[model samples]
Structure formats: structure tokens, C-alpha cells
Target chain A: MIQVENLTKHFGPVRAVDGIDFHVGEGEVVGFLGPNGAGKSTTIRMLTCFLPPTAGSARVAGYDIYRDSLQVRSQVGYLPETVPLYPEMRVREFLRFRAALKGVSPRKARNARVEEVMDLCGVREVARKLVGHISRGYRQRVGLAEALVAEPPILILDEPTSGLDPNQRRKVKDLVRRLGEKRTVLFSSHILAEVEQVCSRVIIIHQGRIVGEGTREELVHRLAGGRRLLVQADGPAAELQAFVGGLPGCSEPRITGSQGDFTRVEASLEGEEDPRVRIYTWARERGKLLKELALAEPTLEEIFARLTLSPAFQEGEAGEEESP
Target chain B: MKRVLVVALRELLAFFLSPMAYVIGFLFVFFRGWETLALAKSFADSGQDLNAFPMLYAMGLCGQMMAVLAPPLLTMRLFAEEKRTGSLELLMTAPVKDWEVVLGKWAASLVFFMVLWAPTVLLLLLLQAPWLLGAHLAAGPIFTVHLWVLLAGGLFLAVGLFCSSLTQNQLIASISALVIINLLLWGPFIVARAGWVPAEGIWRELFSQVYILDHIQSSFGLGLIDTAHVWFYLSTTALFLFLTVRSVESRRWV
Candidate 1:
């Protein structure tokens, strides 16, 4: 339900979000992946109408971000990076205030909406407590509750689980996954595993541009190229390396780690070759013991690093987030 | 309009729930009470005319000092705190117009300013009740002083709101508001007493238009409902609120 075309933002001479084009279909759970200072927050601000675009345009929920900002804002619920809240207000009070601010009409419906979100985000226990005195995890959940209070059709959450503990992070991920089933979800994060688990589609941005975008398998197969081999053997390291080195279509096998009685080595294999079978056969012929042999596809984290760390994308990446 | 009320109500709660609001209110009341008591005692001791009571009590140096300082306390945190705490982003992204948020905040501060001075006005009316019972007190002076205070409060608080909108630092907002209100409050007095330039010309007329002492303070104190002075106070208030709206709107770019 969001369309961004050549969307760009600049702070003085610094280009925070360069010309970028992307679209998020309705009911799609899309993860926006980018490292720090990668213009993720800037992009979210533009879509939510908190910041006007310096150039180009974005349409959120079928409303122009610049021309019809109020309408777009009403249709989209945004949880900013820091979860800004009035600390003196109680959790329920803040959610009620947000419900009214977001145009949740009818006295009954407004109260119902507040209660529904409080229950949905699991903040009912601390509804009566002041927001400032709550723990960080509860505060984050309250922020989420505020976003859901209006029952908007679209959600744009910037770093939904930035500072939460591991358990809280898992809870937030589960919450996002559940919410994405019924609503269009676009959340930004630098965490790879959670995004892979929760999002159906992923967009990798670097230096204000989209460096990679696709499903997890597509990215791993396309951007990361062929498969990689992880071999843990209990034998002479020299013989293993020599054997793996002589195998055809296998690049140089490099020892990755050593622990206990096993030496782990990894190598990139070209084409549709079963290197594990060859390693086993070669080990049997050489009378050496093989402890482990497993083939693993490159993960999203590796692909993300490779795509973002390329020399082409590192030019504008070093600068800090500008004033805007 | 409902959206405006949402913002306004939140502000009201923020103000009334905080201990600092009550502290500021108590201080304002104490100052006005002391001013009234001390001025009344001076009039009775010196055998000065009692007819000048309301004028001296509400429009004298004491009143001027309180008017200059009281509004900053109510307005220092209005917009500056929102900016500093990053809640302004939440406000702008909500389904409310920029002007609605501005007007809501302005209305809430104006209400709090009224709450601060309500007791003082009530006390004056109470003191005059015996005279009114005797038909010895004309209502004109009381009405005039009341109008002047109301309009003056609106104008000064508007200036403070504008100053708060200009910065993210509460101290800076308060100090700048103090400086600005002082300039507005003391402008006409300085100009009228100065021996510079012309005795009666464009400069003098320009100062008189906004001169609170000679025009607003004096005219309204005598129960003279001058339309021009009323317009002057109202338009000044409107100008500051308009500036607050513009300042808030400009933040979306940054």
C-alpha cells in the first residue's frame, strides 16, 4: 500500500536518502535492512510525513505524502525509532490520547480501541503505571500499543526491537509476524535473523540506495552466488587440505576453526557438485577419519555484509546522519 | 476541531497534573496578594484617594512586573519541551493539522494563565462588593481593569508561546520570552518619556499605538473601551500565535 518513486532527502550537501524507488504491496510483510547511518529512519520519516521529501515523492495508503499528508498520516501508524512518549502519562492515558489524536471516533470505539491495543500488545498489566517509571521492554510495548490504538491499515515501525532484551526481541518479532498477517508491515532493522524469520520480503539499503531486494532464497542464491561447504574432520590438517585442494571445481579450502579433536574448514564450491560425497570418499581412500561434513547456503547476514560493504556503496556511508 | 481538543486536553492534563504548575500558580497569587495588600495599606495610611484603587492595584509597577514574569513559567515548556523530547514528531505525524496543534497549545496556555490570575480578579471584585452594595462604586473602573488584564494576559502569554516555539531549550525559551515581553511591556513607557526626535510625530504615534502604559494600561484602567486598543492587543496576540504555527510547520523539513 506504499509507493515510493525516486524518493530522496538531503540535509545541506549531505544526501541522507538518495534517489530510490520501491513499492510495498498490500498485505506484504517487508523488512527494511540497513546498517547504522544508512538513511533508514530518514526514509521512514518521509513516508510518515514527519519530514517532507527534499525531492521526489511517496504515496502512503493511496494518499500523497506531501499533498495529502494528513490523510496519509491517518491511514498509517508509525512507531518512531526512539518511541517518544510523554513520561508523566500513564500507559492507558497515553494510548487514549493517541487514539484521539489519530481520529479514532465515537466515544465507545475510542475507548475500545485503546483497550484492544493494550491487550494486543500485552501492556494491560501496567496500564495504570506512569510511562516514565516502566522498564524499557514495557515502554517499547507501550509504544507499539500506541501505534495500534488507531487500528490503522498500514504500519511503519522504525527499529521495532532496538534496545530490548533477547526475550523481548523475540516477543516483538512474534508480534510483528502476527500483525503482518493482516496488515501491511514495513519495519526497519539491522538484525538479520529476526527479519529473516518474520518478513516475507526483504529490502537491503546502503548509502541511501536499495542495494538488494528479494526473498531470502533469491538473495542467497543470486547475490551470494554458489554454495559454501563446512567440513569438520578429525585427521591430519595437511592431508585434508591437500585432498580438498586437489578436488576439481573446489576453491582453496581454508581452515576456519579448531576445537577439541576436530578441525573445521570451509570452501566455496562451483556448479552442482556434491563436495561432501567427495570428501567422504577421499577420507575413506586415505584412511582418515571425517568428523563432520555439511553443505550450507550463504545466509542473509553474509549477503547483507557483502552487498553493503562493497566499495561502490561505501562512499557516502561514512558520514553521520545529518541534522534533518 | 475534535483533533484540536485532543491536543488541548493533553496540554491541560500535563499542566494541571504537574506540581510545578501549582507552584507557579501559588507564587503568582502570592505576589498579586502582596501587591494588593501593600498598595491598599499605603492608600489608607497616606490618606490618598481610594477612587484610584483599582488602577493603582492592577496597572501599577507591581502589576507590570508580575505581568512580565508570570507568563514565562506557564509557557516555557509548551513547545520547547516537545522539541527536546522528540514528541513533536509524533504530534506532526498525527492526523491533525499544524494550525490545530498550534491553536490547541495556545488555548491551553491561555487557560492556565487565566487560572493563575483568577483569584486576584475575584479578590478585587470581593473587595469592591461592599461598595457595590452601597451603590458608591461605579462598575466602569472594575470592568476596565478586568478587560485590560484579560487582554494583556492574552498578549503576553502569546509572546511567550512564540518564544517557546523558537527553541528546544526551556531556559532559553523562558529567558528569551522574558526579554521579548519586557521589550513589549516597557516600549511605550520608554518612548513617551524620552526627549528624543519629535514631540508629536510619526515615531511618537507609532510608539503610542503599542505603548501599554500610555494607551492600553491607562485607557483600559479608566473604563475607556477604545476599539483601536482592543484591536491592538488582539492583533498582537494573533500575530504571535501565527508565528508559533509557522515555526511548528517549518520543522517538517528538518
Candidate 2:
């Protein structure tokens, strides 16, 4: 559970995180999506109490980040953009140190916690190996394991899957999904597809401002009006364009390309009717062959780009003007 | 206290595990032992009494050496290593209080320094046993000198740890610590010779006699514990430890 109110962080002339507010309820998996220099990491650091907010306040796990930072930190597990690790320490030793640092009581429980997190993060195999000697993927897992050592109720991970391979990325995503089932998990990433796959809700930020925040479908619908159809035919390009363009309620069809026997046409349609049916009927009567006809919906990536680039989504207008 | 012990134990274990601690210990013992023996031999040849002053002087030098060398090795990794490797965030975000982390790191370096002194105890015991076995050995005075040396060494270690906390570069930390300790050790003589301060004044008293070496020499060389000297070492240690804590706390704001 986290509540951020008008949070802003300014570094001299640059506002890294402008006045923006958002909340993630308990057990919710929220993904923070932004391109490079979108102030996502700065936001994460502020929420974690690692950096003092130049203005505004954030309460993490019901504790004020500024007034009760220690409590907030105790309850929230943070994995910074670059997970800092002591290379000389063994995996178990490092985890043990973190356990002690977090003030986890009872000697037996500490040991159990170390073992539990080691297994939970799939780091049991390299428990005895030196942290420095491990691979990047394993090191990231160790970082996550350290965060989970105390079993904090909330997790704030900055680019958790940044440097992992495909398999490792999948593993991390699965781990986050599983963890999010019981705890509040807020992870930041620039990879749209990764966030789409694991995050239930997404918040898109750009230039120190929140540009868009919603479910995938809501965001797509809000940014992209509706779906359109892409059609390619085996006929003269001009004839196909004129035929599709003459259809009522259809915008002028743009001839995409004509290579040998195929001519591709892109048109903006008005309603939800299957444009393929109309195209097929027209092609049959016109003695033309239809090569491909498919409906194309806007993706999360396109929505993200549009929202971030929109003039209304500037930093000063972040929380003042809500977009859908 | 338990957190402090945890950190101290890890630091001590790391010191022993690495070659740096052994190398420093061997060098300390070898050089200090050679200097003490050589001085004793010269005194014996000259038919002078076996005074403890030369031994105190040698120990003071050893204290300065430990002060200059041990800290960078022990402390360079205190905050700098964490910042470099990103473990500092883990420590800072943990439930532990800022003071706990600071004290833990300080205690760790102190324990390591104490272990470095453990071998020197053998030298003291050897020097005491030979004279104690014979009549009129005056073991109390010799032991008193040894305690003074240990106190001075502890003060140096504390100052070194404080300096180490100021920077992340090992070399920079070590060099700055060396310069500071050297200034503190040689400051009295420089001030006394400069004659800039008026004689029989507070300025002269503060600058000429404020250094640790003079205070330590008066107590250990004379085989007496001056409350002022004890207080001086304790207060200096407290001041540096406090500074270390502040330096560490300020890092979070950055």
C-alpha cells in the first residue's frame, strides 16, 4: 500500500520528478513505464526514502516517507536501478548481513528467512558462491533476495529486468507476478512489452510528469480511437484504392505499396463492421484477388508514445490536467 | 550492541582472511621489535639503566604507523565500497537506525585494530617476564607504559576511521589520514619552535601541549596515569566517532 501526494524533486534547474500523485493499493502490481530520463528512478528513490523529496510527501505501507522514513524503509523493500552488492561476501553471508541490518529478530528465524528467501528467489544453487563471481542474472536475483530477506510488505523495484536475458527476464517477471499476488509490487521499466505482460495497471511518465495511467485496454482505447483494417490485394493499386475509397463512411484509402502481384492499401474505417467482408464483396464483383485482410488494433507502445508526446502532457500540466 | 558485534565480527574475520591484515601485522611486529631491541642494545652497551622511555617512544611510532595504515585498509570499504557496489542503498533502507550503522562500522574497525595489537602483547609479556623473574624489576611501571601505548593506538585508530568515512578512494583516505596523524604527532614541536604564540599564555598551552604524543609520553614514560591524558584520548575518540556518524548520515541526503 502506497500513497504519493504531489511528489516533486528538483535538482537545481531540472525538475527530475514534477508534482505528480498516484497510489498502489495492497497486493496490486503496478508498472511504471517511461522512456529514458522519465524520472521513474527518481520517483522510486523518493518513495523508498533513499532521497529526500524537494517537495510533497509519500506514505509507504502507511508510514510517512519523510516523517517516519525509518518505518517506511523497514516496511518497504527497494531494489535500486543498480543493485548494490558486496562482492566479497558469499550469497548466504550477504543475505545474513541484510537480515541483521533489517533488525529481523530471533536467531532461528533469521536463518530460516535467509534460507526461505534464497529458495524463493531461486538462488539456492549459488548460496555458497561468492557474490562477485556470479553472473549478472544471479546477482540481480541475489539483490531481490536481499530485499525479500525481511519479508517486507511492499516492494519497489527500479528496472528489475533491465539487464536480464530472455529466460532470466521471464523468471523475474514470474517472480514479480507471484509476489504481487500477496504484496504491493511497483516496478519501473522502459520496455513496454514486459510491463504489458506482467503489470496489471501501467503508469506512463515522460519528462518528469505522469502522462498516462490506466489498464492496458483503457489506455489503448483512450489514446487510440479504435481499430482499423489493413488490406492487400492482387490487382492494380489505383483500382483497389479507388474502390475502397468510394465505400461510404470510409476515409480515402492510401495505397501502401504495389510489388509484382500484390497491392497493399490502408484505410481508416468508421464503425466496428468487419471491413474484410466489404473488401471481399467488392473484390469478388471486381474480379480481383484478395491477398490479406486483417484488423489492426493500437498497441500499448503506440499509446505510450502518443501520450508522452502530446502537448497537453507537459510537466507543468501533469496533475492539473488529467487525460481521460 | 548485537548489531555492532555482528559488524565487528565480520570486519575482524575479513581482516584475517585477507593478506593485508597479516602483512600489516607482520610488518608492525617486525619493525617495532627490531627498533625496541636495537634501542635496548645501545642503552645496555652504554651502561645506562634499562629505562622504559625508549620502548614507549618505539610504541608511539608503532601507534602512529597503525593509525596511518590500518584505517584506509579497514575503512576504504566502509561507505565507498557500498556506494560503488550499490549495497549502501540496502543498508540505508534497512530498518536499522543510522547510528546503528555508523557504530557498527566504527566498532568493526576498532576490533580489527585491537586484533592487530594482540600480537604486540607477546612483546610486552616477554619484556615483563625477564625482569619480573629477577628482583627489582618494577613490573608496574612497565605495564603502565604498555597501557598508555595501547590508549594512544586506540585514539589513532578512531581518527583514521573518521577520515576513511570522508571519502571512498582507499588511497585518498589513507593519504589524508597519514597527513592528519603526522600533523597531530609533530604539531607540538612545530608550534613550540615557531614561537608565534605568546609564552606563558593559553595559546601556547593549547597548541604546544595539545598533541597526543606529549600527553601519552608524560604518562607512559613516567609510569603514571594522568586523568587529563585519559580524558583527552577518550574525548578525541568520541569526537571522531561522532564525526564519522554525521558523515555517514549526510550521505543519505545526497
Weakest 10 consecutive residues of candidate 2 chain A by summed lDDT = A315-324
Name the candidate that leads on TM-score.
1
TM-score of each: 0.91, 0.90
Instruction: For each candidate, give the interface RMSD after superposing the true interface residues on Cα.
Output: 1.6, 2.2
Q: Report the CA-based lDDT of candidate 1 relative to the real structure.
A: 0.83
Per-residue lDDT for A245 in model 1? 65
DockQ, candidate 2, comes to 0.55
Distance from true location, Cα of B93 in model 1, Å: 1.0
Instruction: Say which docking band candidate 2 falls in.
Output: medium
Candidate models: Cα lDDT each: 0.83, 0.76
Candidate 1 collision pairs:
none
TM value for model 2? 0.90
- Kindly list the per-residue Cα lDDT of model 1 for residues A164-207, writing each as its tens digit: 99999999999999999899999899999989999999988888
